[model samples]
Structures are given as C-alpha cells and as structure tokens.
Target: MDTPDTPHVNKERIDTMEHLSAAIGVSRPTLSRYFQDPDNVSRTSRERIRKGLERVEYVPNFFATRMNRKSTGMIGVIIPYLNDLFFSRLLEAIERAAMDVGYTVITQCSHSDPAIEARAAETLMSMNVEGALVAPLGNHSDLDVHERLRSRLPFVMVDSRPDTMPEVDFVGTNHYHSTGLATEYLARVGGPPVFLAMPRVNFNAMERERAYIAKMEQLGLEPRIVGVEGVSGAGYFEAHGQAVLEREFSSGRLVASSILCVNDRVAIGALRAAATHGLEAGAMQRGGLRIAGHDDYPLCPYTVPSLTTVAQNVDAIGRTAVARLVESIRAEKSSGKQILKLFDGEMKIRESA
Candidate 1:
C-alpha cells in the first residue's frame, strides 16, 4: 500500500483543472465554467466535478485564469497613508469585503503625496482592474488623474472626495453631524472646549473645524480655534499637537478649560503634553483639562485616562464602498447620476470627558 507521504503516490494525483477534467472524463472548458461559477454548470456535470475535486484536492490558480479574461477580477484600494491606524483598519475591512465575493484587492499607499497618488492611479489603470476604491488625497490630489481613470473604469471614492469630482460615487461618514455631536457633548458636561485643529491637510479636518465653529455659535459661545502649523506626514500629529498646546499654555491662551482635538491622534498628543505639564486630563480628574477627539481610533481606549470620541462606522464604509464599486463594474457603465452614502458617527463618553 502507498503511504500518504509517498512522493510517487502524490505525483500520480491530478493537480491542475485540465488534468482533473481529463481524469473525470469531462471537457476542460466545462470544468473552467464550473470553477468560475458552480451554478453555471449542469447538475450532473457539477456533481462530477465535485467528485473529481474530492479525489485530487486540486485548487485553481485564480490569477492564471484571470489573466486570460478581459476583467482582471482585481479591485484596487488606494489610501493616503497605511501607517495611520485609521487607514490601515479601513483597508483591512475593504480587503475582507472584496475577498468574500471572490475578488482580490490591490492596495497602494500615497504616503500623503500627490505625485505618488497620481502614479498609483496610473499603476491601477495599467493593471486593468475591474474596479477601484480610492480614499483620495483631498485638496492635494490631482483631479486630472482621477478624471482620466474614472472616464475609463468604475471607481468609488472612500472617506474624502475631491470637489472637482462631484459626479463620482462617494462613501463616507457625515463629518458635520459627527463633529457637532462631539462638540455638543463636550459643552454639555464641561466648559465649551476649544477646537485644536490639525494642519488643513484633508477635507475631513476642514469639515470638523467648520462644524465646531457652527456648534459653538449655536450655543451662544465664542469659538476659539488653535491650529498646529508647519506639520505634515504620519505620526506628526502628536508632536505638533504637543508643541501647539505648549505654546498655548505659555501664552495664557489655553483658557477654554477643555480641548476638543480634530482627531484622536491630536488628542493623544495633547494628552501627552498635558501630562508633561503636570496637568491631569479627564472628567473625573479635578482641576484638569477635559479632552475629547474624533474617530474613536483603536488606541483611544488604552490611553492614559482613556478617551472620549466620536466613532465612525468604518466597517460599514468599507462594505458599502466595495458593494457600490462592484455594482458599477457589473453595469459596465459610469452612471451619470452620482450617489453619496454617508454613515453616522456614535459618541462614546469615556473618562476623558
């Protein structure tokens, strides 16, 4: 008897779909159609293919098969930065959603650079991808690159959309409502918090700042905006945040009694700065500053005193973006009607206000 580990025994088994079809007395084309979609084959042929698969343990090479077709069966996912936990988590969710439908995800990070973003678009276009989901670089993006690509393929914009691409499909959180939610909560429990703005790198930040100003005005309070200057790139939020806070403290301008950061990263930076100055942060800490942020990032719960934040439905965003793109790809035409899907944010009140 041949043992399972015997080399010759393994070599005798069918390894490819062509060999398996020959062994099962079925045509190779029939087997290929079944592999593409089992429902496409007749019941008798499907049963035969299933039996053959059980005997040989053959797994089809998806890439090799896709190369022969016009559609690559690949979806491109583009983001500004992968090191940021927000984008990384969003990418993972998008990948999961795409794989569930038998499509592969090709991810590219722009590193917050417009030139690199344009290059990434060109690469995806050259790949002949079935569709693409892009989280654009906001104001810094090249509109011509996106316009040319969208003219030829189906693309869904995730998170941020360029103003020039108003006709494109979009999936994102409602920044205005979410920011208002956070601002209102902070004002209700603590003194009206000052808005700690990050450098205006993206539309999301600008929306948050606008929302903060609007909410403060509605409450009949003066809106104080302290922005971090001369900072860009990943991991700069905390450092610039700390520097901005230090300046505010020394200048006696940190008078709001609380600080609402543009995002969780900036809030974390402010927390670090407050700690360095021997000032405690959180609602329960007396004589300390109340701090809050947006996005409810992965690390928010583990912060020194935890964090209060507005949590965007990232999973929903990813799933919706993929679904929309897939629909467009199936339609094979860019619909003149543009669709916008926005998910709401939930406020989580923690120890930090």
Candidate 2:
C-alpha cells in the first residue's frame, strides 16, 4: 500500500540505498544522514523517509553506515547477570532512557565470569561503541580491559565498581544509606539484628556489610555476622541464604532474634530456613523472628510474610546513568575526573520486620 504523500512507485528492485533514496525523493547525502541519525534530518524529510522506507525492501549495511560516521548513535551496556531480575529491570530502564534521547543500546551479558566480562568489554571496544556502561564483576573483573575502554570512549559503571578504578564514572545505590536504614529500623522495632552476609562477589557485598557494621556500632550494639565470606562459592540466590541460616540454626550459634540479610534473595532463603526450623516470619510479638533485607526486591512484597528492606531508587539509577554517560559521550573530551552519583535507598517497612 503506497501513500500519496510519498513518491514510492516501485513495487520491486529497491535493493540499493541510491534506489531507495530516489524512491523516497531525497538526495543521497540526506538519505545517508538520515540513516546515521533520523534526528539529524528535518522532520518533514524524516517522515517522508520513514514512510518510504517501509515501502522499499532495501536493508542498509549496518557496518558500512557506522564506518562513515564519527558518531555511532549507539551505547554499549554490559551487565553481570541477565537472569537476575534487578539487573534486567535496570537494563530495561537504561534502554528506555537511551531511546528517549535517540540512541540504540547494544547489550552483553557477562554471565558472572571474569574472562567473559573482560571479553565483553573488549567486544564493545572493537565495535567502536560511542560509550559503555558496565556492571562490573568487582574483584573478579579484568580492570585492564575497562581501563582500555576508559582511555578511548565515554565509559560508566553501573551497580558496582572494582577497587582499582578510582576515577571512573559510577551510578548506583547508596550502600551506606541503604544498609544503615535497614539496620537501624530493625534495631528499633526488634533487637539488634545479626547481619547475614553474602559472599564477597563484588564491592556491593562489602559496602553493605560495612554499612551495617557501622550502623550497629553507632547504636552501641554487637554486630554478629553469619554466612560464608571467602568468595561467591557454590550456592546461588536463595540457596545461599537458606544454607547459611540452616547452618547457623544447627550450630545454635545464631544470636539476636532479628536478622538482616544482605539482599532480598538471601532474605527469602532465610525466610524459608525459618519456616523449616518451625519459626514464623512476622513481628517478634508473635514469637516470630523479625527478618529484614536490603534492596526492596521485586519479589520482596510477594514473599510469605513480605520482606522488610530498603528501596533503591532504580528509576533514578537507570536514568541518571544514561544521562551521565550521554553527557560524557557528547563532550569534546570526557571530563577525566571521576563522577559518582549515588541514589538514596529508603526503608520499606513490611510484615517481615
């Protein structure tokens, strides 16, 4: 179905850019410019091109188009885990924000492997991406690859950061504020909560743990920490939470009636452990253990007693990361000074605490 506003007379043989441009009634240069960035062309011509492109069957050579332009109109985002809903939500928000400003996102999932993480960074660099956003693998990440990307492109870190890169741009939740909020809130309602720590997978684990310890000390309380600390070993997700809690229960070493888990995943596992131990999750008044977690996860509210944790400003995190990265990308040269944007994490009180 051809429209009257456009010059799309051909039903066949529109396989070349030149022919497509002719069919669309635009100059070759304008067509090329439009292909590079639709916003670069005037609205009228852009609409005409859009309408005509649908009629034609010409597929622009993606690599050829990128080779001709200095601006790729593309941003690369490398995430540590694609299966994790939190990262998935963050990625979704990043994509929407990038699209709002007329940019395409190229995503790579690292699968939580150091070699894979390094390779992902290298792949984006090889593609000549205008910029990159990474949710690093913390201690396990290859910093050299990120360093190389930082040298040539506008690079930003999301969620977590490795220790070596002190001057890189980062956008994430305020771990101190988040963990402290949960710790203090739990102490006030119940007794001082024993910290249930996650494996040292990334800087976030330590950040949250230290924040909890600091808050507990500030309250003049003993900070009892449980769970494995060596590395992100065997157990995944809830399994880690469940196993640690079960071990503490068996050992009869877990003190403090209330428990604060590292995150909602661990918290959920702890809840399961409580149920397994014939303990209920609710207020301490019902002879139940008060359990709280960090990062008011998507499933937190749906948990048996609903998890009481801190709410990270995921919207702000995602939007701010893209804005900061885009700003850096547009700069003639990136401002070398490290930029850190930490969004606040508010306490979300629920039945679990």
Candidate 3:
C-alpha cells in the first residue's frame, strides 16, 4: 500500500535504476535534465529519458509538474455531437495534433445544446485551459460567455460559424463549394436534384443551402429546397423526411432526377425513405433516382449503393484551428472580429451518383 506522500520509489522501482543507466548509458543528472524539460535537452538525452521512464515505471506528479511550468500546457476541444463520424474524426485529429505539439487536450461533447456547450467552455476555462478549439452550437452559443472569455482566453471555432457576431475565428470547410460540388456531380450524372436539409440557421448549413440554390440556378434547374426540423441522421427525423419525399414523389412535385443531402448521414436516411417508398436509388447507369451527400463520413462507402458524397478537409481544419488558437493566445489579442477560414472538400463519386 503506497501513500500519496510516498510514491512507489522502493527497491522494485529503484532496482531498475542500474538497468536504466545501462540502457540510457547516462548519469542520473543528465537523465533528470530530460525529465525537467525534454525540449531543452538533447534529442539523445530525451530518448534515454523516455526509455528510462518505461523501464522504471515512473509516474511524475503531473499536478506539481504543471504548477512549476509557466503555462498549463492544456487545450480544450469542444464538439457539438460526438456521435457524428465527422465531428468525432475531427476531434481525434485535433487531439493528436495538439498532443504532438506538447499540449494536452481536454475534450467535451455538447450534445447539440447551447447551454451545455456554454457550460462546457466555461468549465474548461475554469480549469485554466490555455485555449479552446470549439464546434459552437450555431445560434445557440452564449455570446455573453464568449465575450467574457474574449478578455481572459482565446478560442477558435470549428465546423459552424457564428451568425452576425464578429468575435471569433473559424476553421471549417468550404461549405458552399462542397454543396455545389455535390449538386454538380448529381446534375452531371442524374440531372439536377432537390436539396434537402434541416433549418438553415446553422452557418455551415446556410452556406450549403446557398450553394445548392446557386448551382441549381446556374445549371438552369429549378431549386427544390426541402426543410425539416432537428439535425440530420436521426431515425425518426429521417422518417419525417421520407414521408415528405413520398408525398412529393407521389404528387410529381419532386423537381429533380435525384436529391442532394446535406451530409452522408442525411443521405443515408433519405435513401432509406426512398427505398421504403419503393423508389430505386443507386448508380446513374441503373438509377431510377440518384442520391448524393456531403461530408464523406466513415460509413459513406458502406452505405447502400455506396453513397457519393463531398469530403470536407476536416483534418486540415482541426490542425489549422489549434495552430491559430495557439498563435492567438500567445499574441494576447482577441480582435472580437471573426475570421472565417474555409478548407475545400473533395468530391467522392461512387455508385450512388
């Protein structure tokens, strides 16, 4: 039984000292330098310290260690919903990139609630996190909280842009181009298609919707914008989309040869609805109807007929957000003006046209 005061620095732990020295082939003082600040030490010494730590099973008091450092070396990563593959992958890439830069990531999923997201950010801020990379809850973000954070810390927005608020920096996809790409791909292969989405209050979704309309008009096709409530990819909400589709299909009001979904997950749900209504959806070669999606999720390739979608440069967005946030923090400046950085999306043409 070891007490908090006494770390397991017993014979079992110390016996490895000789082996560690032999392995490292360095004096303990030299090894200590690596632990004190690996970046300051020679690469060889750092490697030796890493090997020694493994052999001796040492666990430094991280609390005391951070207390001694100039900065906490921590970053907060906030995602709207972790269940979505895109958000999850985005967070993972950000975490890995942050860790590589010697910063620890504390992640939180806000579950699509504005209050929850605000609380999450506030909580992380309370912990003295150096900065935050956040996927804000669209219009649900607490501007008051963000305004206060502006005075104390730096935060970068991802995925969704704040509306009419000029107080944040965003690293996200080129939603307009991506949606246009999806629509064009659909139009070229299966003729123009109706664009379906939830409300366009979300910044990304608004951009996507704009692209859809512009592209449809450019191609001389009438735009059919289908509106729904709630987010994409839920079973029940998708069922509602299916009902709408069925009504439109039956009424001959479906204006296009196919449909461009806001995302692969949404497309999957729409495809289910299409199938349930006995409409064939797949490759253009044999398509009775074509379906396209955006944000080529991990499951995009596995979906029925293997969805054709637009793949956002989420990895780049994550990397850019952290790098920018770190820079902004070091600069000690929050312009309270928004900076929107848009990364492009690649078109993944598949059997779904």
Candidate with top TM-score is: 2
lDDT of 3 by residue, 1-353 (tens): 99899887633254343455666577765654455577867887787677656666555556555645678888888888777878888987898788778888988878887788778878888778888887777776776766666667787878886775555787888877888888887878776688877665566777788888898889898998875565344443345456556666777665346888877766777777677666657764453578888888898898777888999887888888888888777775555566679888899988777
Cα lDDT, all candidates: 0.84, 0.84, 0.74
lDDT of 1 by residue, 147-167 (tens): 877887788999987777777
For every model shown, the clashing-pair count is 0, 0, 0
Worst 10 residues of 3 by lDDT: 10-19
The better candidate by TM-score, 2 or 3, is 2
Q: Candidate 2 residues 1-353, lDDT tens each?
A: 66788765665557677887778799988988998879999999999999887777788888778868978788999998877888878998999999999788999988989899888888888888899999987787888888888887888999987777867899999898889888888888887888888777668888889999999999999998887453245376688888888877766645337899998888999899888887776784476478888887899999988889898888889899999999998888655677899988999888888
Candidate 1 all-Cα RMSD: 3.4
Residue 222 lDDT (model 2): 93
Per-model TM-score, in order, reads 0.86, 0.88, 0.80
lDDT of 3 at 288: 55
Report how far residue 13 has shifted in candidate 3, in Å: 8.0
